[model samples]
Target: MTEKNKTTNNGTSRRDFLKSASMAAAGFMIVPRHVLGGRGFIAPSDMLNVAGIGAGGKGQSDIAAFAKSGKANIAYLCDVDDRRAAASRASFPKAKYIKDWRDLLEKEHKNFDAVSVSTPDHNHAIIAYHAMQLGKHVYVQKPLTHDIWEARLLTEAAKKFKVVTQMGNQGASNDGTRLMAEWYDADLIGDVHTVYCWTNRPVWPQGIQWPTNKSEVPKELDWDLWQGTAPRKEYVDKLVPFNWRGWWDYGTGALGDMGCHLVEAPFRVLGIQYVKDVQASVGSVYVDEFKKGVFPESCPPSSHITLTFPKTNKTKGDVTLHWMDGGIQPERPDELGPSEPWGGEEGNGTLFIGTKGKMFASTYSDAATLLPKERTKDAKAPQKYKRVPGGANGHYAQWVEACIAGYGKMEVSSPFEVAGPLTEALLMANLAVRGHDLKGGALKYTWDNKAMKVTNFDAVNKYVKREYPAGFELKA
Candidate 1:
């Protein structure tokens, strides 16, 4: 067997593949690894090269994870913010650096087999799509896209291009996510019908009035690139470095920021979907003196959203999920831990209101304990809740292996199929929030995975497509 056949998937062999192909004068321009794999016993490492885009926030941490990754070595670090770039590049002085991610992808990214994009949700699909087109695998952050269409596009591209992928919720790999899934399967909560999940969003910026012409752009930022697919706006200190999560143009608000992680448990373990009915109320919030329209003109600081899943042909039963953010939580169930405090807060977790018993959890509830802790001790585990085997290892490390191995274990916990659907669901919550604003009532939705947008909503169709600012565009 060739050396490439037996080695584990770390990606160093990608260079060898390209070298041998070049020597043979094959004029190869990056074929999907599976094409070569079927002919011979090529391993994933034969394809593991890597680059990064948006090395800040989640992106920066993703870079750190890549640095610590044993499967594949870091080859590049890309970020728009010099401050974040300088910080991330600090560990891998050898990795290449650039301000514009395109330059890295179009010109030098061939050196990489995969790229992790930790940019805001708005740019996630655009950069990830282009990367897949160039034949590189992708690791995009959670709440995968700012809008629903992007989620579908990215998911399809991974399959069409046959590239391995992961969404950067990282939390998805937590023992808690698995436990939540297992619990659902084991009937631990027995027919979970209602779930309450929440987060403290608007943690950054909220209540943006319509944009005015006066905010001064921060000198440190490349406001243009940061604006990437969103429409142009004057740079403001309020919107840079970390605070944009509250804005519609740059972030997905609380739902987009935390839903992927917080709501992830139910989506995966319970198999909930087809969230057909949504009614929400956004609370009061404000735009900074300098910033405007970056967020909704009149936004709520906290909102409560109720989502209903239809008992369609595929659904076993109906499920309703309620989301609360910005310090608001679904009214505490006065019955949790009867021995403990009544009207207790969920803090940040999903509480399953099941038919048989109850389950209380924290967002970090990967190792969550059941309410009435004594009940869990007496309870027996079931088959569906059987521990999902494999890759309890780090998130970035698994991607490294996939990028290197090419196809073995191609399906990881957060692959596009799973993460993409979760992202779509979370983005739907955002849509519901906005729909409540304009429609003045509950918004109904039907998820057509192929279309990537709500099957309804003609006028809101405008909300689904993202428009880019000057210069930065989704590359072909």
Candidate 2:
């Protein structure tokens, strides 16, 4: 038995303490707050104990947000690299530090109420799936999974396990998304038929050959553990601390990195689900005067992909979403003044084109505005949905509260049910981007959502479900 389930000197286990605390008001007289502890004290049982996996970079901020919620206690921290995990370990000095996530989950599952997965895109699904199987609530970072099959599996797992799940696309809980939905519902933009979501990502290296020389593994890092689900590879510099997004082996390119944030607005506003078909055009890289670089392992420096979704209850016809990365963007709408920012002050944004008008929002779906710029001034829509307490910042707390309330009690903004479809849509777009690199791959690829395959291109179908290394295989 685990330490948490062991009997205490008073003949009560921690489980028993929790059960009794839950039954306190029903089974016995309630004591006043002042008599119990003090004016603003919270019982230990009321707190959600969270175990953090990948405790560095985005992982660090994710757990810090949960702790900021005041109802969540950072119970454990796990990371493969000590250097990357230094700050988080210092911040949560009391949290049990573990080097391997598998060890933490296998040995300490009973100690925490939930798990936060902030690892690379390739490992997101496996970690989250395992945690869900163990009956733990999970909050995973964006692009939920590297492949479409994994997203679908996790979506079904959440339903089967009946656990509260949330994706780390905090923008789903932002007021801008809700406001955009309100405008769409109000018919302010009529029926949206097209959306353009663009980003200036791949800020990392892309369209390049893999490093020919391997570097010595850093003493503070566990190279093997870091390559968890990926096939074994020699240690290389600049892949860690954030350049992985450019490689197919460990990252999902710009589409996977920023698609969740930019496309989420349209998904929430238009009620879009799985994609119907996709096609793409990508910029080429030439190695020399006569030779064109064909690096299959790396993502293209730039690409423009188009995804089509069948008509939903919210729309009159099919919807077309254009995804552009590496600084590509759509043509400027005539409705906007020359001085007005196309997608906000930033170069990245999502634009919705409806029969009546056009609307757009910047990254994180912030600064939502109607085209013609002036239309935004007179736009008014009835508040139809309840706003999250702190908007985008409330995302972490929202999951914490819902987990404490138990599954199906409270709602989270980016639950797996919704995130699954959104993520699959982006991954589908990636199929087209990757296909662009193959022979006769530039043509449109028809998608069979039910089968989760590309009906037109057999070569691209292999990417729908990636093969894992031994001991890391994902079971259906």
Candidate 3:
């Protein structure tokens, strides 16, 4: 057999198939599928080969979801911690395993058509950006990047590379969000001027000091790789696996963890883009009778941030969005009965206040409802948009199929184009949260979207674009 058509023990080689497929698309002679295989057989070229980075926790589930599509091959797996990667390694035994993502991309880029990045918030932008530069499609976890600048960079890169891109906010594809959009379109709720998104998060510890006691790195973990873009620091106990969500160096606090999922509903329904200004009030922890504990390295225990957005084609005037976390919630709307749930059964949800009526939805934008409880019974709106086959769960397959179909060939629910601004808005809210402490008082920060900085307070602008360690610097 010719080298290009060489087969592995089972069948055609993925790398060779990809090469041949590219040539065919470039005007080379096409081979008939039946001639190459039986009538009912599917070609290897039809399947998307995916390389998974951060192959544990959310990463593990993401890989499995893509595999569940039955149209993806988990061709490679890379993780900083072997212990964490164990399950995925056992699940996809054929996928080559590596300790560092940089090495995997360097040595095996030819074998995969896409990359799934579920790494910590700090590392998301760098890994995904590099993969896109190599002309591979990317699926990144939500709160797209750690900083506003990074989010904008990835968005531009997606278009520049002409590669399929998706952010891991599965709710963007859920039926509830689409229904809300349809309802708004039908004027079931008139122009929504105000929105409230709340969640009980920081389930991980926050508003505390970083542990000073250094701990030996686990044998199964690569400490350096885990700290990818963040400043170098000693390894601390219990920081890995989950608790990183509470730290500023590694996580975006509660807003980063849940903002994408909760705020997405109003962002879509109102067609809002970047925020024009943001103000925040944070709950402080008292160390004793005289002093409040100051843990600048950690996120506050609670915060209520307000972001105002300029008017869009869908609204008559500017929109105001309220984001509350750390167990804070908006006042219960009087339209509902006293015993009725406030946000949703879970206490995490989004509420929309409009001129004519109101609407709300649970976390992930699921189970949408109208106000007054009774209004929901007969609410009607035309389903103007197409729904994914399996709703939110279908997010993975949607990206996989879109990658196989090539960029611009298919539509994904949360492409970088839509996700970028959404993420920036959340990060903008965070800027205010952090600024509240930096200013030592409550203050509103005006945003210059074009300049990508805080126009009023220059101190908070430092976070608009963060400084990275030498090796991890993000370059244009």
Candidate 4:
């Protein structure tokens, strides 16, 4: 457990709030462009002035990468929760802290050259969208957004804004992921078919849960602001700090948590254009007392959902991809081979079965290898595709370099071009869950990438884009 420990790189532990305040007070005066970062001088032109819109867990991780470059000026830190905002200010004393992202956009839009949107899945589009419109380069974290429409809008908006863009699946640029794809392209295994990817999360339900806000609202939390794009609800303590990932209103269930990292490799190397058709079934097998108060009736306490994507005729033949989550697994994943157990307590890692052999990988798309053991060494595959490059300066560093360089080159493996579609497809899984849950029926739809809309299923179609809270429009 990486509980917050109060210590700096120099090993001086923060003994009291007083000591923290005193030390930070001195830090607040220094120009972050120079003093806070301890690296050799970089040309002012090379420094990327960056503002972070969400500075909780992942948000701070992105900031750390930028701070590491010693070439970043953390011009501003923004969070909807006052507690988060205060903690971030204490964490990066050099950064100016703000409450509402809109205030930063309206007043300090030009203060930073690039902005990192690390909010939850639902808000990703709003923050990143508005930032790009202000002409700032943007990086929004993965499961790009909470819904399919948001994903499409983001991809198109980035192109329209012409800003350097990256999704927070940092593994996209890692050496391991590159090797994973290269191995498949090498035909170390024959044509791949069927993928079994799973994660153990969303211990809660999707959609909304209600009356759970009975717990006192923390003085530091701005419940209304935290509900930025989500439907407003009373304050609930358990939902804050953590446990927000399982709710549909704020998150995209299991797919949102692990999809970008797990589903990406198979989609990329295979060059899958679209799922063509998708379906999901969600059911609750646990809970006795009213699971209300924390979550709305629309959500289940725990759910097992399966997603299937039928290969289009354009895909040449049929390729069925299966997703398992909520701590469930196939009876015998071993038929695939010796494997690692996942899904928290009970889930299987991703499986890819090919006509000639099989391959399995952990969540990050690293640890990828062939099946049937001997087929790996004897395999013959074309060696023509140019080798992809490994990530150099961490996630934020790459984006920062692009911001300063004025043009960001594609990293290939997990660039927005690939991550965007994968994210949209996965988000659709959330809609499928809602469809199945509401009517005990399946969701059927057609996707037009050009138009970015579902041809049928209006109920789920309404889900493509959710209503944002007032004044949070993401405009181009």
Candidate 3 lDDT tens digits, 1-476: 34554333222232433233334334422233334453243444588778999899999999999999999989899998999999999999988898867667655665677899999999999889877777789999998999999999999999987999999999999999999899899998788999999999879999999899999889898787788788788899999989999899999999999999999888888899999999999888888999999898999999999999999999999999999998898988879777877666666999999988898999888888888768878988888999998999999999999988889999999999999999999999999988866873467789999999988888888888889764455675
**TM, every model:** 0.82, 0.91, 0.91, 0.80
Report backbone clashes per prediction: 16, 0, 0, 8
Candidate 1 lDDT, 1-476, residue by residue in tens: 34543213221122232223223323327654445443232334443546878876667777777656655556788877787777778877777787767657655644667888888777887788777776678888877888777777777777877788988776666676666566666777677778888776656657655446567655445666667777765665556677777677778888887788777777766776546656677775324566423244333578888888766332368888898888876665645543564222435667777777667666544546565567767766553432323333477777776677674355466888788777877777677677655663355655454555566665555666666543344422
Candidate 3 weakest ten by summed lDDT = 9-18
TM-score of 4: 0.80
Per-candidate local distance difference test: 0.66, 0.86, 0.86, 0.64
lDDT of 4 at 271: 64
**Per-residue lDDT of 61-114 in model 2, one digit per residue for the tens?**
999999999999898999989998899999999899998676676666656778
Model 1 weakest lDDT span, ten residues long: 6-15
Candidate 3 wrongly placed segments (more than 4 Å)? 1-45
lDDT of 4 by residue, 261-366 (tens): 7777667666665556666655544344755232333444334444445564323356777777766554444444457442223343667777656676665655
How many residue pairs of model 1 clash at the backbone?
Answer: 16
Superposing all C-alpha atoms, what RMSD in Å does each candidate have to the true structure? 8.6, 7.5, 6.9, 9.8
- Deviating ranges (above 4 Å) for candidate 2: 1-45
| lDDT agreement of model 4 with the native | 0.64
Count clashing residue pairs in model 3: 0
